[model samples]
Target: MSTMIFSRTDETPGIHGHTRDCTGAKGSSTLAKLGKGDIVVVDAPDINRTLAQKLIDAHVGGVVNTGAFTTGNVPNFGPQMLLDADITLVENVDPELPGKVKNGKKGRLNDGKVYYGDRSIGQGEVLDEETARTRFLDAREALIDHMEALSGNTAEFVSTEAPLLIDGLGIPDLDVDMDDRKVLVVSPDPQLEEKLKSLRYFIREYDPVMIGVDQAVDELIGHGYRPAVIIGDPDLISSDNLRSGAAVILPADPDGHAAGLERIQDLGVGAMTFPAATGDATDLALLLAEYHGASMVVNLGPTLDLDRVFDTAAAPGTPSAMLSRLRVGNRLVDSTAVAELYRVSRSGGGWLWAILGILAAVVVIVLIAGLSGSDGFVDNLIDSWNNIALKFQDLFS
Candidate 1:
């Protein structure tokens, strides 16, 4: 038996995605937190791939939620990760079931019902490993269907949003010289993060402009750099970073209601809003960079992957994104290919080479002087060389 705990869904007033409400206090601030051998009851309609994968990573005993635990509407790696981890997942449980599960109560899942303190809180369908795998395959099939539908309508959508490219003409008070500059747009993806870490050599060599999308600003901070520009919904960004002087870009709807407009304006920060052209904030960031004459855009963590399209917000935009990529072409590089293209030896140039060059010249001059036939020159050179060798020996010692 494992300890049981309850958490609100993303729809809950204050719960962020896959939040943990630790410290025993329940409010908008408390995220749901649990550990190994603990059963977590959540109110979300579906266990999203990210959360499901996280539970598996945390080694949780089991999960009880109101919805199924596939990739939701798109194809993603979450379901596959969960299946591989072999964590217990039960879904379609009643929302009120968590309440009936008293705190500190011991619970166990048998068949489809969760029993706590000899009482059955609710019943659900257990998602075995094979079922999870099947769901992932189905989600990927749906993504293919979505891409096909979008490919069918791409010419239409591109025609509609093509004029919107002019909308990226400018932000009210921000100025950036994007011509011929490499721009790195970061999104909050674990794989992207790891890829970025591995490409530090390339990053140092090029020093591309860093753009953070929403919560990815924090990820940028974690990597020892601050974003030059932060784009997307303002609510997802921390006030401290927003005030750190990065330009903000918002995605606007046709109705003129822009995501994060009020908050950004309330903070008195000027932001440029472009009519929503793509699905997720990262896509919007890439569009902004490309439209503004960026010479090159390197994306870390794009949702263009088949597994990535499973996110609800990303699924619809999958088609639009395809068109956007076609427009950007080789100018847009994902993190995966950065190493092969930009990675090079650090000794190519810079101060390190300058110092080595100076030392080499000094050694050459000394050798030339030593080769002189003059007895006095040879004597002085021998003494100086002996002194230098002694010094070198002392230094090494």
Candidate 2:
């Protein structure tokens, strides 16, 4: 239990999720100002109480919850624990809504009763759940639109193309022969921490490059691994990490905190700054590693699958960044591979038996389906054949 009090002036729609999950465009920006050890009191009572408890567990200080804990269906114990722990709890500041007073920023409830922060000032009203969700979705759509708009723009084309020049040189793949290439990716969010940790074994074995995007550097440093490459603009990642000896690749545009080429020069280290092409630089860093001939680039916190892409792309610049990397043949490591490798490496007889059982089951299924004369069975067989055909297309197309 940490004991301190801090205030958030901005009550952005997504701040609750951001503070809890530690991702999202505005959340990342705010989180960069606070670290693992810092404490801040929040004004929003509508925040998920579970998230509040998580923050307390992580040693966050007392919160001055403005709205009554019960107003938004958020947990009661979340605030109760703070009171139980003797953490400062302030409630019912009516003249000045608890959120506004705690945030120390003036805001107004919109016609729809949602909080809309002034982008320039970084302050907004606290929105109700329905409005917040709607705004969040809109923000996502806007980001996707931005990514699409920037994908082929000259700035993106130039930045993305400069690296591809190496491809034309016919350079042999650079052997990532360094046995010491072990990497640890970090994120402050527990869910993200679990996600990254899931791939720990694969990261350890096929270690090629250690790359951290934004606050991931803090997470990595906490785990005793200094990143070789730190991607993203200086907005979210502390200037201290950027100044540290790690190679800093800045973003191109201001939207995604795209590091400027000049900042790369100022860093006074071997650095690469890409034009803020349409995607996040984390994706760029991974592709850049692959393009530069890393034998096996094992991403610790890299985004994989369509769902993750959609989630990450909801942020302003991620959509274009992801789309651009996809064009460059950047390989998104499969989560299944992570599970398989871990099982094979960690499990013994049980894994072997499980594999044998799966193979036997597959064989039996194919034989039975082949012999079954019913139309349903035949339809299933044709669907399987089409799936195989699609896989072949993916492999060769």
Residue-wise lDDT of candidate 1 within 21-81, one digit each (tens)?
2212351222234556666665544345656655676676666666666544654565456
Root-mean-square deviation (CA) per prediction = 12.7, 20.5
Candidate 2 residue lDDT tens string, 208-238:
4677777777766665566667776565666
lDDT of the structure predicted as candidate 2: 0.49
lDDT of 1 at 383: 74
Report clashes for each candidate as comma-separated counts: 11, 8
Computed on alpha carbons, the lDDT of every model, listed in order, comes to 0.67, 0.49
Model 1 misplaced regions, further than 4 Å: 1-148, 152-156, 165-174, 306-314, 340-397
Model 2 TM-score, all chains together: 0.39
